[model samples]
Target: MKKKAIVLLGNKGKKYEYTRHNFGWLVGDLLSEKMDLFFRNEYTYSFAEKRIDEGFIYIVKPMTFMNLSGQPLKLFVKHKKIELENILVICDDVDLDFGRMKMRPFGGTGGHNGLASIVREVGTNQFPRLRLGIGRGKYGMVDHVLGTFSKPEKELLPSLLSKATDAIRDFFILDWQELMLKYNTKVSV
Candidate 1:
């Protein structure tokens, strides 16, 4: 099936709004604002919908904790009747440098509890994903992922967020492989 929906992996509470762990969620929020879509709580997620040339592209932020993100997603896909292959997950990756990103057609979660949960629930890791770089923290991995951005990172976020939003918009118009190739190596200014 063609990729048709987007699942942004992030925590939901206001406490997590600006935290590194919330990159994917923040992107979803930004995209919603830009597109004038308001997400409503439903079927275990904060969900919104938009119709492009092809069909409805869902914007979902799982209401569950990051580690259990899949619960909502599993419910979401069943509710929307969307196949796992037709969804794209956007998540933060501590493995890459800030401002850098990678897009993959399918892969392991690389220890991300959120991705792992989704994989287990969905019974596959073959779905598309966009991993936004947050860089490894000198403090600690756990601390890093939970912490808010630094001054420099905060300064750079607008540009990064813009690029990410654009990439997601492309998800509706381009094939997964083509979107991955176009975004994987491109660093945001």
Candidate 2:
């Protein structure tokens, strides 16, 4: 069977740009550039598709605001007939240190509203997820999530994003166990 996956971006518009919440979108932008796919707005989401040798990859940025991300996600999944295992939700995580990443086959929302929306829409948390860490700031959790990356964090983003893009590719090329062993950790940025 063809291996298919949907990569989700977490926020929308100028208001949320560069905020920690948009890290998933940033990663998707990088990958889209690398893959040479340009997104076009459709069905309340911005999306692009690329067909690689193995299967198809879909990159999605839900126009739905952060708290209601699941609407477009569920619509896309159902419209495309994609299985939960084939979907990989990418979002920012405050709990991890900046520049770190974690991948899990299934889990709870980890207190992220976007994730909670997804869990609610899907009716299960069995899908894979790529959690990109945007460490907390001095102000506190809310402030940190709402804030953009600092100068140092901005400097580190490309390398971290590169690693993340590679992880996504690895999900296609290698088995889950191998990919997890190779990539689930902090890497030098």
Candidate 3:
């Protein structure tokens, strides 16, 4: 089995927590808890790893913040000797409605700063990614992404995050194509 990396992208600090932009970290938090893993901090990021069967799953949270995620990610990949195909990035997307998600085996950044940094540093948009939607409401893109969840959204958030984590856990067991087919549809939560 190949060693795989799951990169959960988000900014650091309490100020960013619960904001729309921190969705990736939120998912990572839930995943860590579910897996009973603890992230060990490095200068650029924090990461937890678990060995399974003949492979390993590395969960990475970039502490370099969101925009500079690529620097730490690039270093991690090289250090772990993980192939690009084995890497999966998770992040928030503004295009899809809130609570909806989309996964791609490989694609462009789609205007995400963290993703763009990853693409630039990794030198390709050919890696797999799971995008959790944080839809743009009436507010400007900056405001909407930076703001915390609305009351209604907060009510529904736990289920959404749990589902996202489930999809992530599925990544290791199922083939990427099958996982996409199963998760890319309308997910009611």
* Global CA lDDT computed for model 3: 0.90
Off by over 4 Å in 1: 1-3
Q: Tens digit of lDDT per residue, candidate 2, span 75-160?
A: 88887788889888899988888988988889999898998988898898899989998877798888889888899998998898
Candidate 2 vs. true structure, TM-score: 0.94
lDDT tens digits, residues 1-189, model 3?
669988999888999898999998899989999999999998688999999889899999989879999999999999889999898899999998897899888998989999999999999999999999888889699999989999998998999999998888787779877998988976788
| Candidates' RMSD to native | 1.7, 1.4, 1.1
**Model 1 pairs whose backbones collide:** none
After superposition, candidate 2 runs with Cα above 4 Å error: 1-3
lDDT of candidate 2 vs native?
A: 0.84
Best by lDDT: 3
| TM-scores, all models, native as reference | 0.94, 0.94, 0.96
**Alpha-carbon runs more than 4 Å astray in model 3:** none
Candidate 1 least-lDDT 10 residues: 1-10
lDDT of each: 0.88, 0.84, 0.90
Tens digits of per-residue lDDT, candidate 1, 1-189, equal 232678999887888889999999888888999989988988688899987765678889999889999999999988888978778899999888999888778999999999999989989998989899999989899889999999999999999999999988787678867887788885848
**Given candidate 1, what's the lDDT at residue 157?**
95
Worst window of 10 by summed lDDT in candidate 2: 1-10
